[model samples]
Structure formats: structure tokens, C-alpha cells
Target: MKAILAFAPLFARLKGAMLLTLLLSLVTLAAGIGLLGLSGWFLTAAALSTLGSVFNIFAPSAGVRGLSFIRILARYGEKLSGHDMTLRLLSDLRAWLFARLFPLVPLARRFGRGDLVSRLLADVEALDTLFLVALGPISTAVLAGAAMTVVLALLLPGAAVIYAVLFFSAVLLVPVGLVLASRRAGAEVVAAGAALRQAVLDGIDGHQDLVLFGARDAAVASSDTAARRLSAARRRLGRNAALAGAMVQILAGGALVGALLVGFVALEAQQIDGPLLAGLLLAIIASFEASAMLVRSATRLAGAAAAADRLQAIATSAPGIAEPAAALPVPPGGEIRLEAVRFGYDPAHPVIDALSLAIRSGECVAITGPSGAGKSTIAQLLLRLVDPDAGVVRLNGADLRDVAGAELRRRIALMTQDAPVFLDTVRANLRIGRDGADDAALWQVLEAVQLADFVKALPGQLDAIVGEAGRTLSAGQARRICLARTLLSEADVIVFDEPTGGLDFEAESAFLVELPALTRGRTAIVITHAVVPASFDRVLELRAGRIAERAHVPA
Candidate 1:
């Protein structure tokens, strides 16, 4: 419940729309009760009236029609306002979650891809019904029940206490009991749903592997198990809700019976007429309409509560890195230095231990090493994705931690080994390097990467929408496209982690040969296992978590 309450601030932001929804719901429920009560009273009175008596049928009929119209209009408005607010809230939740999530990048280490996707889509969706079920219906039920009790109190005091007790018990006690009983099941349902989604995502992502390994049946079985778990959990939650609803019905019946008993005694004492008694009894039954709605929503409330807890966990988790409180400006020169830096998954087994290195501005340096030699860790350090446990990483003598991350990133662009080409136009993908870049610049970078001909031959040229992850493009083409994007960035420093990762031997040689001329004026650092060409200014080989050798080459 506390986790659910964590979203109170977001709810407050849309208070106006939510308030309107609640008001319309109250009006709708009230009008419904009044219509039922009046119809009963009007029919009975007309039946008991004399044949020639001045019975106002038109007045009662008009009142009934008016109440019906109000109910229809208010119900429509309630649904309209409620759904509008719901969509807006969902938008806000997604935006807020993304904003929180971006700062915590390298999320792969802590959260699985499928699990994060589930949180972003499924978990957020689970919270959309929070207000409609958890707040509005309960409020409507209480107010409607109170109004009916007051009417009973005035006309037949004997039944007032009976109605109030039974009504409150039905609305309040039953829902509370349902929530408590369904709490565990609701959490299970959410967990099972997330698991099912994860299973499906995993199967899709690994479908080719499954087919190649002849494990398709295993994957199908896994997905089936997840689906069955989700279904079973939902059944448990539904069962609890069904039982609670039955209890509410029993309470409603008891309230009606108690009212009848009191109404008879009051009629015997000449305190109430038969028609009036029928009207009050009918209104009492109608008032429980809100309670029925509340019971139905009570089950959803438990599910929503569980979802809120999951969302709150993500929202409240501390980011891996924190921005400096007072940021320093990046210096003009693109000199990068790592001094006695130490970092690793396990602190004792440092991947980069006491490793110190420095690169002057406008120099192109290539760092080469065997697999698991911590080549990529250096790239992460340069980008400040992870802070070192023991030393300082500086940009032009200013500590990387002293500058705003965004400012630092703008000055230093990195092309990671696994950089993805998103599902967008070729032009759109390149523009991410430098927004608003002209066509000539795009073509120049493409030409430098030897990809101009490939892109120009396409029907839409730069505007051609590529498939997701550049599936439409070959592996070498995708790698070059990413490399061109990095070359397009107007940064003082550009780091390429395996820039020619998927290229053939001939293409890789061509790219390496042109790397010097392409990044001639920037501080370029290339982390690769490829053969270092003579054109590079310097080369360093890493071994045993330290730079073991360095060689300088003349222009």
C-alpha cells in the first residue's frame, strides 16, 4: 500500500480531471438510485390512488425521465474524463520512467533486457487503472450509501441504523477483506505475467538459435509453462474476488431483509405508508450498486498495488553514477588521462589495475589486446559510464567527475562495439551524431567509410528507412554505418570500440588505412584486435591489465 501511495504526486498533477471524473460518477450513481426509488413510489401511489383522483402522473414521469437523462449524460462524461486522464497518466509514467532509466545506463548488468522491457511496457500499464478502481469507486460507494441512510433516517428511523450498518459493512468491510485475501495472489499474477512476457521475448530473440540447435520444442515448453503459471495466478485472484462479491451480495440481501422488518413495524405504528416503504426499500437496493462496482474493482486494486511496488522500485533505485553538484566546463584540448585507475566486477580482481595512460590532442592511438583483456573497460572509463574505485580519469586536466556528463559526452563521442542502428531512416540515424547536419556532410562521412555508393544506390538514398538493428543492411554495412555516424560527430575526441568489427579482411585493411586521414584533427582512440597500420601515430598493446608495450610511428 505504501508503494502504491508513492505515486500520489503524479496523481495530484491530474487532480482536476480526476476530480471531474469522481464528480460525474457520484452524479451518475445518485441519479440511478433516485430513478429506481421514484419509479417504485410513483407506480405504487398511482395504483393505490382513486380512479378519479388528481394523480400527477406527468410530474412523476417527467422526474423519472429527467433523472434517467442525467444518469446517461453523467455516466458518459465519467467514462470520457476517466479514460482521458488514464491515457495522459500513462504517457507521463512512461516519460518519467525513461527519464529515470537513461541515467542508469549499462542497465544490462542489473536488469535483463526482457525484464526491463516488461517494466517499461507491462508494469506501467498495470498502474493505469489505479485511480478508477482504488479511489473513485470506493468514494462513490461511500457517498451514495450515506445519502441513502440519511433518507431512511428521516422517513423510518427504525431501519436507518440497520441500513447504515449493513451498507457500510458491505462496501467497506468486504472490499478490505478481498484486498487482504487477494494481495498475495495479485502479486503472483503480476510476477507470472512478467515471466510470461519474458519467456516470449527470450524465445523470439533466440528463435534462430533454438532452430539451429533443434531445441524448438524446449523453448515452446518453457513458454507454455510461463503461460500456464500466469493463467493459474489469475484464476486464484479471480476466485478470491468472486468470493468477496458473493459476500457483498449476502450483505445486500440482509440489509434489504432488515429494512423490510423495520418497515413493517413502522407501518403498523402508522409512521410510514406502503408506497413510501416500497420506495425506500428500492432505493436501498439501488444504493448497493456502488458497492458492487467497488467489489469488482477491489480485486484490481490488489493487482495495481503490486504493479505500483514494481514501478516504485525502479523509480527509487539509485543511479549507478551521479552527476556533479557543481560542474566544471570541459577544456578546449582533448587530452585524456587515466591515472592508476582500478575497476572490475569484483574489486579484488581488477580488470584494469593501476593502468595509467595519456593521449595528447589530435593524436590517433589504437589499443590492442587479446580477448578478456579489459579493452572495453577502458572505453567505459573514458565515457564515464562507470567510475573507477581508486583513481582519476581526466579530460584536459579536469576530472571527468567534475564536468557535467552531458557536457563531457558532447565533447567526446564514442562508437561502441555493439552500437545499434535504430529502426529509422538512414539520414535520421546519422543525424544522431550531429543533429541538423547537411546532406553534403553525411555523404562526406559515408564516402570516407566507403559506404556512399551503397547508400546512394538505395531508392530513398539517405531517407531509406532501415530495418530494426539494421537488419536490412549486411553486418559489414551496419558496422560502417555506425562508424560513419561517429566520424560525423563534431567532437574533439572520438573513441571507436572495434569500429571495423564486422568488415572482411580487405575492407578492414582499407578502413584502417583511412582511419588516420579521417580523424586527422581529432583525438581518436581505437580499441581493436586488428593489425595496427603504419599510418597510426602510436599503438599500445595491453596485457595482464596493464599497457605492456608502446610503439610510435612517424607520419
Candidate 2:
């Protein structure tokens, strides 16, 4: 509940619209009750009217028509305002959540992609019911119930007392019981639904591997099991809601009978007329319509609460690295230095230990080591993806920690083996490097990476759609496009981590041939186990978190 309330500030932004919607909803409910009451009174009075008797037909007839018009108009306004507010709120919330998620990336990868997607898409969507189910309905029920009770009391105080008791019992007590009963099951439903979604997404993403590994059947089975569990949870919640609804209906029936009895007694004592009795009875029935939605709203409360908790887990989790309160500006020259830097995912096992290195401005260096020698870790530290545990990594004489991550990244771009290629047009992918780069600049970078000819041959050229993760392009083509993107950046320093991991001899050689031109007048760090190009100014080998060897490569 507390987690759900954390969005109060967001709700505050639409307070004006929400208040308007509430007012309209109240009017709609009131109009409905008035219409039913007026119609019943007019019909009964017209039936009892004798031939040529003096009956005020015009007034009641106009009242019925006016109430009907009000009901229709108010209902339309209520739905229109309510849905408009909901759409705006949902749009704002999605953007806000993504903004929060942006700074925590790479470290946020600890939560699997499927799980994160589920939270972003499904969990956030579940909150739509917060306004539609819980807030609007509950508020309308309270106000309408109170207003009905007062109106009835004006006519028959005894009938009003009975109506209030039954109304509260149905709206408050029964719903509370339903909430209690559905809380655990509703939570289970939400959790199971997320799990099922995750399983299905994982299967789709890894279906090839599953099939090759003879595990496709197992994957299918897992998804099926999750679906069954989700279905069972949903069924449980449905049963609770139905039971609560039945109880409300029973209470409403009792209120109707009580109203009838009270009306008959009052009429016999000459306290009220026949038409007034009929009107009051019909109004009591119509009032219960507003309270009818309360039970369903209460049942959904648990699921909404569960979704809020899931979203809060991501919202409140601290980022991998904290931003400095006062960040230093990036220096003009790209000089990187690591002094006694030590870090590891686990405290007991350090990846980089007491490692010290320095690269002069605009120097090209190749760092080579076998697998798990902290080659990639060095790139991560320089980019400040993960902070060093012990010593300092500095850029242009300022500690990386003292500079904002975005600023540091602006000065130093990292291109990895698995650089993500989004499912968008080729122009969109290239624009990620330089937001406003024109077609000429794009072609220049593409040519530098020797991929311009292939792209130009495509039917759509720059506008060509690249499939998810660049699956539409060959592996070597994808890697070169990533390099072209990196080259498009105006960063003074660039780091490549196994950039040619899956390339063949010819592709690697072609990339190496262009290495000198690509790295000219820029600080470049190539971290890989593959053959280092002879054009590098210096080569260093890392072993067990230490620089074990250093050599100069002849130009």
C-alpha cells in the first residue's frame, strides 16, 4: 500500500482533471437515481389518476426528461474525463520509470532482460486499475450512499436508517472481507503472470539454443506450468469476487424489502402518498447500483498493490555507481590513468588488483590477455560503469568518480563485442552516435569502417530497417556498423573490447588495416585476446590482474 501511494506526486499532477472526473461521476450517479425515482413516481401517479382528475402531469413529466438528459450527459463527461486523465498519467509514468532506469544500466542487467521487461510492460500497466477500479468507484460509492441516505431521511427517517445500515454493510464490510480473502491469491496471480510472461519471452529469445540443446520440450513445459499456475490464481481471485458480489446483492435485496415495508407502514398511517412511496423504493434500488462496483474494486486492490511493490523494487534499488554532488568538467586532453585499482564482483575474489597504468594523450594501446584476465574490467572501470573498490581511475587528472558518468562517457566511448543494434532504421542506429549527424557524415563514418558500399546497396539505404540485435545483417557487418557508430562519436578516446571476436581472418585483417587511420589523433585502447595489430604504439599483457608484459609495436 505504501509503495502504491508513492505515486501520489504523479497523481497530484492531474489533480485538476481527477477532481473534474470525480465531480462528473457524482453527478452521473445522482442523475441516474433521480431518473429512476422520477420515472417510478410518474408511472404510479399516472396509473392512479382518475379520468379528469387534477394531477400535475407536466411537472413530473418534465422532471423525468430533465433527469434522463442529465444522466446521459454526465455519464459521457465522466467517462471521457476519466479515461483522458488515465492515458496521460500512464504515459507520464512510463517515461518517468524509463528515466529512472536509464542511469542504472549495465549494473541493472543483474535483473534479467525478461524480468525487467515484465516489470516495465505488465507491472506498470496493472496500475491502470488504481484510478478506474479503486479510486473512482470507491469515492463515488461513499458520496452517493451518503446523499441517498439524506434524501430518504427527508421522506422517511426509519427507511433512511435501514438503507444506510445495509449500504455500509455492502460497501464497506463485505468489500473488506473480500479484500482480506483475495489478498494472498491476488498477489499470487500477479507473480504468476509475470513468471509466465518471462518464461514465454525467454523461450522465444532462446528457442534456437533450446532446440539445438534438445531442451525445447522442457522449455515449453516450463511455460505451460507457469500458465497453469497463473490460471489457478486467477480462478481463486474470481471466486472471491463473485462471493463478495453475491453478498452485496443479498444486502441490496434486504434494503429494498425494508424500504417497501417502511413505505407501506408510512402510507397506512397517512404519512406519505402512494406516488412518493414508489419513488423512494425505486431510488433505493438505483442507489445500490453505484455501490455495486465496490466489491470488484476491492478485489483488484491486492493485485494493484502487488504490481506497485514490483515497480518499487526497481525504483528504490540504488544505482551501481553514485553520481557526485558536484561533478568536475571533462578535461580537454584524453589522458587515462589507473592507480592501484582493485575491484571484483565478489569481495573475496578481486579481478583487478593493485593495477597501475598510464596512457599519454592520443596514444593507441593494445591490451592483450587470456580469458578472465580482467581485460574487459579495465574498460568498464575507465568508463565508470563500475567504480574501483580500492584506488583511483582518473581521466585528464580528475578522478572518474568526481566527474559525472555522462560527462566521462562523452569523453571516452566504449565499443564492445556485443554492441546492441536496436530494431530500427539504419539512420536511427547511426544517429545514436551523433544525434544530428547528416547523411554525408554518416556515410563518412560508414566508409571509414568500410561498410558504406554494403549499406548503399540496400534498397532503403540509410532508412533500411535493421532487425532486432542486427540479426538481419551478417555478424561481420554488424560488428563493423558498431565500429562506424563509435567512430561517429566526437569522443577523444575510444576503447574496443574484442571488437573482432567473431570475425574471420579476412574481416579481421581488413579491420586491422584501417586501425591506424581509425585511431589517428585519438587515445585508443584495444582490449582483446585476438592478434593485436602491429600499428599500435604499445602493447601490454595482463595476467592475474597485473600487467605481466609490455612491448612497443613498430609503426
TM-score to native of every candidate shown = 0.85, 0.85
Quote the positional error of residue 163 for candidate 2 in Å: 1.2
Q: Taking the tens digit of each residue's C-alpha lDDT, what string does model 1 give over 1-555?
A: 898788888889999999999999999999999999999999998988897367879999999999999999999999999999999999988988889898888798767776787788877887777887668899889988888888888998889898999899988999989888988988888788777777898899999999999999999998899889989988988888888889889989999999999999999989899889998889988998889887778888888888888888888888888999999987798899999999997887899899999999999999999988999999998998999988999999999999898898889999976899999999999999989799999999999988999999998999999999999998778988888898898889999898887778887887788888989889999999888888888899988889955665542
- Per-residue CA lDDT of model 2 for 1-555, tens digit only, reads 788899889888999989999999999999999999989989998998895368878898899889888989998998899999989989978987888787787734567665787678777777864887787888888899999999889998779999999998988888888878888897888788778887998899999999999999999999999999999998999999988899999999999999899988999999999988998889989999977888888877777888888888878889878999999887698899999999998868999899999999898888998899999999989888888889999889999899987788789998998898889988899888989999999999988888899999998999999999999999889988888888899898999998887889878767765776787988999887766667777889999999855666543
Global lDDT of each candidate: 0.88, 0.87
Name the regions of candidate 2 deviating beyond 4 angstroms.
Answer: 52-66, 107-110, 208-225, 325-331, 351-357, 366-373, 417-431, 434-484, 498-512, 528-555
**Residue 93: error of model 1 in Å?**
1.6
Q: After superposition, how far is residue 301 of candidate 1 from its true place, in Å?
A: 2.1
For model 2, the local distance difference test gives 0.87
